[model samples]
Target: MIRGMAHHVGIYTRQSEQRASKSEASTETQWDDCVSGLPHWGLEPQHIERYEDLGISAFKDVDRPDYRRLLADAGAGRINVIVVHYMSRFSRRTAQETYDDLSPLLRNGVRLISVGEGREFHANNLFALFELLFKLQASHEESLNKSLAVRAAKDLEARLGGYTGKAPFGFTLVRETRRTDSGKPVSVKILTPDTEHEAPIVRRIAELADNWITENDPTGSVWKIARTLEKEGHKTRGQRMAKARGDARWDDKTVKRVLADPRIAGFDVESVYGTRKDGTRSTTVAEYRLVRRADGSPVQRYTPIIPAEQWYWIQGWLSDRHPGGNPHWDGKPSGLLSAMKLLFCECGATMTHGGSGFKKHYRCRRRAIKPGQHEGEVTIGAKGIEQHLARRIFAVMRAADDESALAVLAEAANRYAVQRERTVALEVTQERDRLLSERARLRRSREAHHADRERVMLKGGFVDDFARESWGETEQALAERMRSIDARIAEIGDSKAVGLPYEVWLTADTDPTGPGSWWDSADFQTKRAFFRLFFDRVSVSKARRWAGRGFPVETRVTIEWAGGVDLSDRPMVGVA
Candidate 1:
């Protein structure tokens, strides 16, 4: 022992219970061992400082507070020696990492000692350095091998029809008595149906889904089903319900998850693991198989609440209604003009549904929440706005000719081309593709508008002053757009030509009729799509009521077209 040097000894200890057994060295035990062996190294209790990282893995670079402090002290030449119960207690990091961390401490005149190995690491000793490297490598290998062994055991257990983790909903784990090697009784847990409490709820959910798929029930949508379940005082398993607040209610996502799970069909499912950004494994259900099955035919893991046929049927329904599949709108009709993204308050807040049916009005949602802070709810009768807008749209469609329509289309296409070029130059592939798709959709709409205009032009040459003024305004807007694009290109340091090629004018089949005719025949979904395609937004001013006027007194509504045209000055007349 190197004695009588008046050394300051620092004891470092770490114990991750998750990675080690009960018999392995704990933080408390390691601390005790280090304190007891201080006299052997000619160090007193007064000269010793302890650093402990309890329940923290040595293999991970976690924020070990005490360990970090100890390293700082060593670097500052405050600690002359570092004592650990074992090499692994200090770190189970690879040999290179272990060497790198300790080199600075050793260079600062700190001695490394392990009590369990009864070894002292000397800075100048080649043999001691070799031994330190060997110990670190062994520790790292042990952790790796242990992880592999545990995963293998879990896989084997899963294959043998055993639930390795927590049992899913509608089931409970029951322990069955078994004889051990010494004929002593032990318990083995297995999954069984929880029929009394959870099973009935699962059955009801399956029945509702089946009715929706097979019986064409209108009330069986996921949102409706969730609401129904909540109303019936049925709470989902594992979800805590607050009796006072009534906050814990069934949601659409929960309902969808329950319907999608294959476990309800009497199967055992295993998760496919994925690597996360933090270098941790994230697991998701990948595949399913009938539990306790020997033959190729499907077998029941337990008494299934939902029949196999009904379960399969529900799966087919889900697939059809999925986002990737053909359009099958399952949502309820919001309102007449709700599909039109055309209602906003002067304060730039969106207007949403406020009143009940027939008496319904579009109210500024932000103002409604805090009436004193914001401008009081700017509202307009839904029917009045819809009627006035419909008339205006009809007039425009009827008066437009092929020449005027083509001019508008060309201006819009030029703006889109510039936007696309900027997006591509920035190397934003996703955003560029999205802009291109929108441009394609606009092209199709333009073609339909041109066709309608051509039909009207053939009937009468309606070249009025209003049409001429509109064309002049449109031309001015197009020139401004070109200037704005040029400024943006200059700012981004790109000189690429934003020219629209002939191939970019590809069109699609979208129903093209006079606005009035289209509105008369179009369904709710089609009406919504049409409104979204043409108009960007609508701004509503605060209502002005005269003395002896009714509830809504001449609310001023302004419509903004998608093609940068503003009609704020032309206020639509309100309904009585």
Candidate 2:
């Protein structure tokens, strides 16, 4: 019989638990918590056998053989051994080994007492089974608790947009700043690091890989690249040489890793976890990092580290090298019809392609020649319209070169300025009342006040209602004065100064014979662009008979630039 127990007992519990504190309540039947003072309950002093009395002078004397021999004697009903707790004195490497070792003692008459647990080892089959179940439950509970804690941590990280798992090369987790803008005072929150820092080495690696691919270097595999990096004094994340294997300085795996890593280019990497053939975990890339704007909007980040124009030239060169002509259009070719796409008819129909003889034209797809319900389709060739319009514009520009046109422009500019000044001078005295009232209302609305209105009025006060009433009369007077001066200037200049291109009037006045040719000198894109910019649409019909005489090969070409004008009753010329 055990006499006095130690003050505190050591109950070896599962890995999940921490040692109980002194303030924790001690239990008599639960061996899960270690406690002592067992003999103090009721045992007599004579019944207690100290370590010396039991032939064990020191704790070390209680070896395995000693315990085994004690168990054998107990099995023969020769002795009983007492323990403060079941786990206190029972020590083995594993539960299975401990159970095997204790089997002999269980087969004997040794009734073991766990004073703390009030348990007696009666060598019963049910008792041994119960112990095994208890240990298994303890292990399962410990695993579940650990899994829950880890899950909670990962969820928190995702919510805060923090990195949760392993760090990618060239990136280190760093704390992000959070601020509170309370009225009383600002506050800051400090938390774990998560953001990746941009590394220049990533860019260097990509540039190197791109160069290798372009040059078609035989020795420039990923392994070679890593070796070169190491030779150049580069280090890994651990800041040491990556141990070289075989004849290669760096392995193939290392080089491939560097080339394929988008993070090397300083982008947030995207990857998915995968399992390898060897049943080991691995990673597969989904996409690379994107360049973002200041507000995190994506935009173009790289130009391939190659010149665009040069790249196109090389592609064409390669195509030609293969004995076939390049089938692609050089996107930068020059064109006169660049603005054609913006041209459309007021009727909201796109111009359709049409040509007569050799001349190409763009005409309204919906137009009909006749006004009544019987009106049929209209058509126009592109060449006829371009030539006619170009001639008319050339005429107007040339006419403007004369002294008479300049005189007219100068006279208009001067007269308008004088009229504008006089109107302001006469109205200033009464203009301030309304202006001030408007300003006050604008201020009350908390709207920003601008000085543009006041500045313009101060420079030239606006015309009042009374002045406005007579403004038309004053404008007419100014025009007559300018016209009279212009006519005098015209007398000194040639008649061509006032008349538009002599050809323009001829086209407007006389009818021509057949469709014209224009597309010979222009490509498809140029012709299309011209049609879009020069004319809204053209409407044409085969010569019609009115009163039994055929109307002069009549057509209408609608101009788009400088405000549209329609040239009607025009002739279409047939190309030889």
Best-fitting candidate, scored by TM-score: 1
Q: Quote each prediction's TM-score.
A: 0.40, 0.27
Model 2 global lDDT (CA atoms, 0 to 1): 0.40
Which ten contiguous residues of candidate 2 have the minimum total lDDT? Answer: 50-59
Q: Which portions of model 1 miss their true places by more than 4 Å?
A: 1-10, 18-25, 45-56, 59-73, 76-80, 166-508, 511-576
Local distance difference test, candidate 1? 0.62
Residue-level lDDT tens digits of model 2 in 299-375: 32222222222222232222122111234523222222222343233354445554545755555566554333233
User: Model 1 misses residue 234 by how many Å?
Assistant: 15
Local distance difference test, per candidate?
0.62, 0.40
Q: Give one digit per residue, the lDDT tens place, for model 1 in 336-409.
A: 56523467777777677657877888877672454434455577887677666555443334333544434434
Name the candidate that leads on lDDT.
1
lDDT of 1 at 309: 51
Error of 2 at 255 (Å): 2.5
Clashes in each model (backbone N, CA, C under 3 Å)? 1, 14
